[model samples]
Target: MKKVCKGLGTVLVLLVAIVVIRASGSAQLDAPKAPAPLSVQPSESAERLGKAISFRTISHQDLSQVDTGQLTGFHQFLRESFPLTYAKLTVEMVSEYGLVYRWQGSDATRSPILLIAHMDVVPVDPGTEKAWTHPPFAGEVADGFVWGRGTLDFKQGVMGIHEATEALLAEGFVPKRTVYIGLGFDEEVGGVLGAKRIAAHFAALGLKFDFVLDEGLAVTKGMMPGIDSPVALIGIAEKGYLSVELLVEQDGGHSSMPEKETAVGILAGAISRLETTQMAAAIDGPAREFFDTIAPYMPFGQRLALRNLWLLEKPLTWKLTQKPATNALIRTTTAPTMLEGSVKENVLASRARAVVNFRIRPGDTVQSVLEHVHAVVDDARVKVNPGEGAADPSPMSPSDCWQFDLIEQTIREIYPDAVVAPSLMLGMSDARHYAPVSEHLYRFAPMMFTDQDRGRVHGINERIATGEYAKVPHFYAQLIRNSSLD
Candidate 1:
């Protein structure tokens, strides 16, 4: 009994020590430092972006569906809008449509900094055309918003980069390090023919980049519950993609008298099992790194859980999985996108097929995803085959480097209220193609987006606030000048 009492006392003391240490750490997060103010006129910036959105450079999965004329017209529009940029930088076309621009710097030894954005946007859903407040292709500027498909998903980046260059050139600002900008045409459909070819061109020339920046996460507002201000997420790594075809074959017979378990039934059961037994959820990897960066600003209770991660990992993961957005950050997500079985209502089809798509997380591979699917299904009757697109997880870039610090500093200068953190990009981007040429690749768009605005991307009534759209050019200009000037 005495020993038991002693052990209890020791445990109490340990708990008290943990509380004290966590309280000490919380003090460091109490005050968030704001960067210097960014100054710019919003109306003038929105005019150029609105005009850029007028050209419907939509990229379809079927290359034949894309009208190449629209792409050419868009290129012409850019040249006419930014004459100063055309005068300063040398621009060339790759793969007939993709654009690459070079701005020579004073120093020849330093590797160039690459800025990339896609010119193409996803097509509006065919039947849902009438649902938009402003037509998807209209480039309408009304109600303090620039409404269009590409306004958010990426036309902002394309126009913003050019605007920044034109502004800098007008002021006679030249970079000390070479700068390269790549505007890809088919990023919406995997960028294979666009960014892939341009990356090859750079690789063939034996060119290396000091760092690469591409469109990704933005300054998101109201994402974290306990934290009020915006969180600026910078993607240091991107998840991979894989699609698998699950086919089941069985003997066909009349619908009036059929076997107890048909092909359709078997496939349905397998899919259900796979969904129920998902890959384990975790709070480690880049997700953990994200929480560590923002933990200091969170409320006391939230900070306690993040600070004492070792004791609360399971609970934290459970909390994260409750939200769809946060859930994808920690685990490889699986969704059964397509399924086909019977041709007629009265027929018992001999073969049934289903397509399951997976966004593979870092530390997980294409092979591992297949292995898990097979193990969970556990049926020799069903055969699994690789589908069209399959890519292994990408390598993680360094978070602690001169390039990252420069990005952080630039963000502070533009958005003083944002809390910056490194994140794992759950969606696909053209940045993946440039991984081989650059050791440090960071993905961020430097724009403000609310949760509703996030839903608008690839959805109806897509738009960007005129005021927010204007800040993008300023952000890029600061990033370029700060990183290269000295």
Candidate 2:
């Protein structure tokens, strides 16, 4: 009994010592004190953003649903709105709607930089329009918000970049390396015509970039649980996308005599299995680095757990998975998005169908996800097939590069109080298509958002605060100026 007690005590002391050492070794990363933010007329930017939003350049999965008139109007509006940019830079349209603006640099040796955003947004749901305080397409600036469809996910990026460039041109500022802005018109669906072609154009020219920055992570508040300060998340990598259809076909008859298990029941069971047995979670790649960087800012308990993740990965994963946002960072998620069981209420389903969408995380493949589905479902009654638009995750960008350092320094320079951390982008972006051209591709939007505002992006009442909207232009201008110094 004494020996057992001694052994337990020794283990406890060892654990405590290790935790203390890890915590002590961890240092909180901070941005150096920066100058007061440049005065960009935010109110004017807000008004301009409203006018930009009035155009309904919406992305529809079916090409027939697109309105070409709206695109032309929006294109013309940009030219008229930013006169200095039009005069100073060479603008070209790739694949009809893809907008590319080139500001040629003086030096031949320096590489170029590509700034990206999508000009298109997802169409609002049919019945959800009435729920908005302001109409979705009216582009109303009311109650401090520029309310509209693309405000958050994200025409803010589109207009904001233009707003910055126009302001920079006004000052007669020129870059040492060329600056290219690529705007995709169909990013909300896929960027085949827009970003893909823009990428090809750049490739054809054999023009390599220092980095590519697009819309993804943001300066979000109160989203992460442990950290108190607003975190400026820079997306160094993004999750892959895959959709699988679960089809169950069997004999169908009247509802009078039903079998023990119907076609719909089998399909439901498969979905349930997929949900319950999700792909395994791990803290590696961008996700792992994200936690490591943020650990010093966390509370002692959280800090201790994170710093010693090598010893406590399982329990820590359980804790992180409790929340949906953090959970997504570490795992390939399974969401059953669509269902088609029966046409009529009284009739049995002859063929039942379900579509499960997965945002594949790092360290997992499309094949592995399919294998997991087959293993968990384990039913011959169901047939699994891949849906359209399956994509593997983009290659992870290195955070150690001068490109990342510049973005981090810029974020810190603008918002000295906020903590800057590299993150894995959970959503898909047009930035992914640029990998063939640039090795350093990052996705970050310079807007601060709360938890509620987070849901508004693709949901109803999507908006951006007019006051905060000015920072978008200010940050971009600074980044452009900083990037210019060769």
Candidate 3:
């Protein structure tokens, strides 16, 4: 009896200490103040963004299907619109449409900074073309918004960078650190041909950047549960991509007389089993760091739970898995996008195939995921093979570095109401290709996005508010100025 009482007392004391320590940490946390605002002309900036979107620079997975003329026209449009940028910055075309502009600064000893964005946009689904309020490539300014495909996904960064650089050049503001602006044309399908080559070019010259900034999560509103303020997620790492084809073959027969199991039935069962047995969820790595940073500002209950993640990891992970967005952060997500079997309803399938795509989480590997699939299906007949473009997750960038601080400070200056946090990008970007060039690659786009706006990305009615569209140029301008200063 005495020993049990003593153990209970010790447990109680430890719990109390955990809460007390978490409380102290929360008490010390205060929101950072917003920096002074920089001004931008809404009409001029919006107009330029609109014109940039007018060009249909869509990337097709099959290069032969892509219209090279559209890519060339877009390049010509950029040269005509930003003549000041063309006159001042040394622009070189990488591959065919990849644009790399070098703005030589006063200091040569310091490694340059790279600003990344893509010139290409995903091809609009032909079926959904009529569903858009404005034609996908019309680039019309309507209802106080710039409506176009790349208005949010990227073209915002592409034109925004030029707009900022041109304004700075006109004002005679020269950077103390050299700056390179890289715009890849094949980022939509995969940057293998475009950004990959650009990074190699820099590598051959023994070039290293202080940091590389690419289009990623933006100033998001209403995403986090407890925090009332908007959150700006600077992507420090991106999930790797893997696509595997599951194939099954069986004896063919007529529909009237079928065997006990057919190829389609076996493949479908395997897919079902794979989906039912998901990858183990973990509340660690970048996802945990994100919650840790935001815990202090969350509601009291959420703050307490998050602050005690060591004790409540299981429950928190379960809660995160309840939502798709949060779920992706916690584990490698399995999505079976395409499946094929019989060509006709009357015929039984002799062979079946399905493509299962995975966005690999940090601390997990492509091989591990494949192993998990094989283990889950547990069928000898199913043949599993890795599809093309399988890649492991990119290495995590340092959050404590000056590059991150600069990005956070710039975001605070532009959107003071936002709570900035380091994030793991679920989608692949051109930044992955630049990973070899810099250890400190940060992914952020300086636009304010809401849940509704986020859905518009690669979806119908994609648009950006005139005011929101205006702020992007000023944000890039300030970011360049502050980071370039000696």
Q: Look at candidate 3 and give me any clashing residue pairs.
A: none
By lDDT, highest first, what's the ranking?
2, 3, 1
Candidate 1 lDDT over 1-486, as tens digits, reads: 999999999999999788657745543323434432334457766877778888889898778989999999999999998898887799999988999999998889788999999999998889998999988888889999999989998999999898888888877888889999999999999999999999999999899999999998889899778888888999988999999898999998789988999999999988998888888778877888898888888888888888888877888888988888888999999899999998998999899999998998898999999999999999998898888779987778888899988998788778877888899999889999998899988899978888788779999999998878777888888888887756
Candidate 2: tens digits of C-alpha lDDT, residues 376-433: 9999999999988999888899998899999998888777778888999998988889
- Residue-wise C-alpha lDDT for candidate 3, range 1-486, written one tens digit per residue: 999999999999999888767845443324555543444467877888888888888888888888889889989988998898999999999887788899998988888999999988987877999899999888899899999999998999898898888888888888999999998988988898789999988888888999999998788888788778889999999999999999999877789998888899899999999888999999878887788888888878888788887788899889989999999998999999999988899899888999999999999999999999999989999999899988999899989878899999888878877788998999999898988889998889998888888779999989999888888887898898888755
* Candidate 1 collision pairs: none
Query: Residue 294, candidate 2: how far off, in angstroms?
Result: 0.7
Model 1 clash number: 0
- Which lDDT values do the candidates have, in the order given? 0.87, 0.89, 0.88
- Assess every candidate by TM-score: 0.96, 0.96, 0.96
Instruction: Estimate the lDDT of model 1.
Output: 0.87
C-alpha RMSD in Å of predicted model 2 compared with the true structure: 1.8
Cα error, residue 104 of model 2, in Å, equals: 1.1
Which one wins by lDDT: 1 or 2? 2
